[model samples]
Target: MNLKTFLRGIHLREEKELAEKSAIRRVLPEGEMVYPLSQHIGAPAKPVVAPGDRVLMGQQIAEPDGMISAGICSSVSGTVKKIEPRMTVMGETRDAIVIENDGQYTPAEGFGAKRDYKSLSPDEIRTIIRDAGIVGMGGAGFPTAVKLTPKNPESIDTVIINGAECEPYLTSDHRLMLERPDELIEGLRVMLRLFPKAKGVIGIENNKPDAIKLLSEKLSGDPQISVQPLKTKYPQGGERMLIHAVTGRDIHSKMLPADAGCIVQNVATAIAVYQAVCCSTPLITRVMTVSGDGVNTPCNLEVYVGVSHQKVLEAAGGLNCEPEKLISGGPMMGTALYTLDVPVQKTSASILAFAHDPVAANPSTPCIHCGRCVSVCPVHLVPQMMQVAADFDDFERFEKLHGMECIECGCCTAACPAHRTLTQSFKYGKASVNRLRREAKAAAAKD
Candidate 1:
């Protein structure tokens, strides 16, 4: 098979053996569940239930506050304990809805009833997704409803399902694809009905040959949708790179996939869409990988959205020892988890507990101007130059260098001999630039 890929990416040890073969296991929470209101990328959800109110499993607990926000649903039947500030995976406190689990797992009215997608209209499908609180699920957590209804729906010619689970030690999506290929295809069909002219494309990294072959065979005899295998590489699943590899189209930071006549959805997100639209199941539970050498058992588990990290770790058979580091996602772009006291949100992907910290042991040295960082950059940005501009707080120079285009994939840092914090600096620089813009707008408004 001819493998497709984008330009300029580094290959690392996949390290997927830890949990790739483990089938997804469902784990119920032991105690109270905490649902953070701000699970998606936009505004935080607003609480619809008050304290002491009874809520059922799959019941809407929070509603979308802004046009860009996503609603929140309860994963288990319980009483609303309170709405208070709670610590999340980001290591910050945010308003969250807490529920005391009654252990009944009682479903709301009409939950889990199967429906025929052919009978539903495009608008009804979108509404079902929005109400179910479905988001990117790959990690971005962008609301799926808004992404499907882009500015020019007619112009979209390709709908890409991202089966490229490129991140190391993450296999939730892989398991989902292999276990439920037909459901995934059905989910794609739902989206395809929304755009009449668009053809569906499923992009999978060749490393997962089983998934690729399974999905390819499942999609056989179907002209509207096809499977495309991609060369395994770091950040191959990055929205821009994936778009380019599958469609041979390039989109910059300012352009959405819709602008390039494409729409990309994650593998797990597709399954969630299928369950939501066809089975009347909301986005309450999702499969996540809990792996790393520090854990007693590294396996993929279908965890509920509001389950506490402590509960998740316990379900993994507890830790083997004190981990040197804990990450909320995968190694490449995952966030450093300061504590296990936080609750899992819709955006949570993996919980990695490392026995040792490799990066910390390799102390940073000065840049040697080897230009290796530039060679590995998926977006082709100069990390050395961007680092200098960021160090000097030169936002203008950074902007000129297309700093915003950097996907923060950590390719530069991994490829760098000096072990410099390229991704971290770029994140800081971008935050500073955005802060300045906000300040300027505020000042202008006052004037």
Candidate 2:
């Protein structure tokens, strides 16, 4: 296991054997299941079941509102079929809900229990991960109880976990770390009892040597857990470069990682927080990775979280060709999709596609200042001076040269040799500095 490397990133082309020896499989739920209502990242869950309601499967049709909200179940059992807008996965349009399918997925009351996750409690596993609306399925849906709400909770210490699934045709967190490494080490000992003076590690990346030998043989003798391995690079599972490549620390620039003592998380968000706290289940189904080159039979499914994306490319055996662009989560921070009737949520891990080339690959020239976008910046910032201060509008010297800690992770438009979209000009200079900080907080709340 000679892995431990990290320092700068990029090494692309790991199309990940299309679907890394496929296996997850079980999707079923096509005639409806939209849900949306702003999948995580705070303040959205408000529906509470509507349109001819009837719901069931893990119930709770949206509720949480304050403390960094998150709650929304009902991954199919019946009716609803109407909450509104649609589209999502950042293509826009919002609201969702939908539902419909009555092919009876039934099961809802205290969902699939098999508890004794060492007798729960860290406030009963953060209220079953805030009522099983679990977020952070690792594409940044955030709000997994606001990363276990640690605002100075005694300055954490360490937890990491990220399994460094360094993206490139994502293998749904390396097949959920080679098929649930002991339910992600029992959800990393239930998030180490919510920061009991932390210490957990588990990084994993030496190209998944059988998921670091099955989580170093289920963290044998676990001296407060350890694993490590890493070095597979490319946004090395981010969260501040996996807490500076596992514990060398450097979290700063508007801090987090619980202010550098650490927290990180994501080995499929610790096995979806151990199936949302000991199998009560909710976050409607995840584990995607259907792979690219316009898929023919690339695998990894366990989908459901609102299915579609062309029913996971017809369960991965349909379009062996006709693709020309259709991402969703892994082609380096995936997204570019306009169709496949969008759906999957809880931060879908990979749906790709890309085939087109009727010949027209030209425009993308200027930007030869050649620092290879500041030598493959993995947050070293200066993405060519934040895309030349966002093409000259100079957003206050591009937010004083930090430019919102650019985690756009397109790695300076893939180390531009002048194919400079430079991460879409720092994503339109961070959407014109968050629309001028929401119009200066709506003119200071109208005085």
Candidate 3:
């Protein structure tokens, strides 16, 4: 089938064979799960249960403060071990609720026995989703309900579901599409009805022909629905990148997809929305891919939130060789794990370990004044110039070059023949600028 190709993306070696052929299994680890209060993007959840208190599975342990926040719940029947600071995906320690599993699996009262979503109004649908604690499962962890209620309704005409698992070694989304295609379509239909004016599109890369074929066949009769197969490329799954690929529109620096008359969601988030709205299931468990050359057995697994990285690695048959580096998500955008004790959260797509010398093969050398970084940048920014400014600690020059606009997709770094750490330098530069802004605000407050 002819696919609707997108502009400007690189194709890295997809080591999906490690987990692509395998199915998602369950990680039945019994112990204390370090459930962080701030799993979503907004304000951190305020705990309702104390250390001595007991909680059943699916019980709302924390309530939402605002519309942009999702509620928090216990994933297992356990006693509150403690509520203390713990390491998170963003690599900072924060307040977390620890629960000790009792092995009973006692679910909270009236967990799934709720009214059907069809009976509810559009506002009611949003309330149900917010109440169930559903967020963007695609790693951004933004509140789902907020996305549904567009601030500027006049701008949006499309709601795109990102099925493009462009990052290598991540097959959780793919497995989800194969296992839960019907549920996905049902969720999409619900979304289309919610956004009456906007058309619904499911964007999948050509690499996953089976998913495209299956989903397209399912959505055939629906006039408002169409399946667009994107060319297999890196960063195609990004909101801005995917939007550009599917709609030929570029989201501005200070705006969201909704600003461009579009709101994109991950395929996993859509299925979760279906379960939350239709099936009345809370966001407790998420599918994750455990793969890399370091692992002996690689496969996708449904892991309860707060389960440690150590447990997941063990489930993947432990490491074959001592890994050079361990990442919380995929290699490209995933954070380097400082400790394996960091529990898996909603945004986690994969746990990657590199045993072989992938980085050692090409060590960083001096930039050869090549224009490759500028040419390959998907957002059309001069990454090389920004890197130079950052290296010299010239904050003025760095900020002037639209350094903050850089998505840090690593395309510039990946394409550099000199193997320069352009992404890392840019990240530091951005952080420094943010810090300066914060300090300025503090000084203004004092004045």
Candidate 4:
């Protein structure tokens, strides 16, 4: 069978076998749920319910504070214990809503009731997604409503479902595709309603033959939807990379997928959309892959949002021992967690515990100027040049080298013989450059 893949991506040990076969099981939150206000990419949600106010499951507790923000819904029936600072998986503390789960998950009126999407207008559908507090569950955490409402929906000719789940050790999306294939399709159909001209395609990596076969069989004889199996490769699920591989399209740093006549949603995100639009169920729970050699049992759990990482690890039969390394998301692109106290948010994909910390154990040495870093970059940027620009504090040189375009997929660092921290350098450079730009913009406004 002919397969599709992007160029210049490194091939690593998939490491998915650890948890891919595990069926999804609901892992209820046993402790107080801590809902971070700034869970998505835009402005943090504003609390609408005060402390001591009683809330039910699926109740809207917070409202969007800005144009690009997302709303927040309570996942359990309880009293608003307090609004306080809480830590997230990224090792940062932000103001959050602390709810005392009363054990009885009482649903709000109209919650979980079935609704026909066919009768609703596009605007109504978009409003439903916004109210459900859905975001890009595959890791980006961008508000799903904002993604659905592009500037020019008419230009959208292809709607892509990102089922690749290409990140190592992350199988939440893989399981979602297998367990809820119909719901996934329904969500895509919901999206196709907004862009009546667009045809939907689900892109799955060939690594998941079971998922590909299942979705294909379910979608048999469908005119507007089909499944396309991609060649197994790291970062194949990256927004730009997947768009390129599936549709032969290219989008740069300044462009959105809509600019390329496409819009993409994650496997779990699509299923959530279906639930929100059809069943009136908010994004309260999602599948998470908790696996690695450090954990005694590897499993895909449907965990409540705002559940602590500590509780999640326990739900997975606890760690085999104290892990040398712990990460949120996947090994290639996930952030290292300093503490297990961090709460899972809408974008929480997986919790990885490793008995061995390879990167830290093998300290970085001076770069040997091997061109492998240059060759393996999916975006075709030169890592060595970007590293020099980053090290020398030359933002202009870094921009010229396309440092901003780096997806930070850890490809260059993985390909380097010298074990350099190339991805981290680019990340730091990108943040610093953005800060400088914001300062410059402020100065111009004063003038």
Q: How far is candidate 3 from the true structure (C-alpha RMSD, Å)?
A: 1.5
Cα-based lDDT at residue 329, candidate 2? 84
TM-score of candidate 3 relative to the true fold: 0.96
TM-score to true structure, per model: 0.99, 0.34, 0.96, 0.99
Ten contiguous residues with the weakest lDDT in model 2: 356-365
How would you encode candidate 4's per-residue C-alpha lDDT over 1-447 as one tens digit per residue? 558989989788998999999999997776599999999999999999999999999999999888899999999899999999888888788999999999999999999899999999999999999999999998999999999999989999999999998888888899888888889999999989999999999999999999999988998999999899999998899999999999999999899999999999998999999999999999999899999999989999999998898999999999888889999999999999879998889998989999899998889899888799999999999999999999899999999999999999999999898899999999999999999999999999999
lDDT (Cα, tens digit) per residue for candidate 2, span 82-121:
8899888678999878888888889788787877766766
Tens-digit lDDT string for candidate 1 (1-447): 989999999898988898889998998886799999998999999999999999999999999888898999999998999999999999888999999999999999999999998899989999999999999999899999989999889999999999998999998999999888888999999999999999999999999999988988888889999999999998899999999999899999999999999999998898889999999999998888999999999999999989988899889999999999999988999999989989998888999999899888998899999999999999989999999999899999999998988889999999998999899999988998999999999999999
TM-score for predicted model 2 compared with the true structure = 0.34
Looking at candidate 3, the ten consecutive residues that score lowest on lDDT are: 1-10
CA RMSD of each candidate after superposition: 0.8, 21.6, 1.5, 0.8
- Per-residue lDDT tens digits for candidate 3, residues 402-444, read 9988888888888899999999999999999999999999999
> Which lDDT value does model 3 have at 211?
92
In model 3, how many backbone clashes occur? 2
lDDT of 3: 0.85
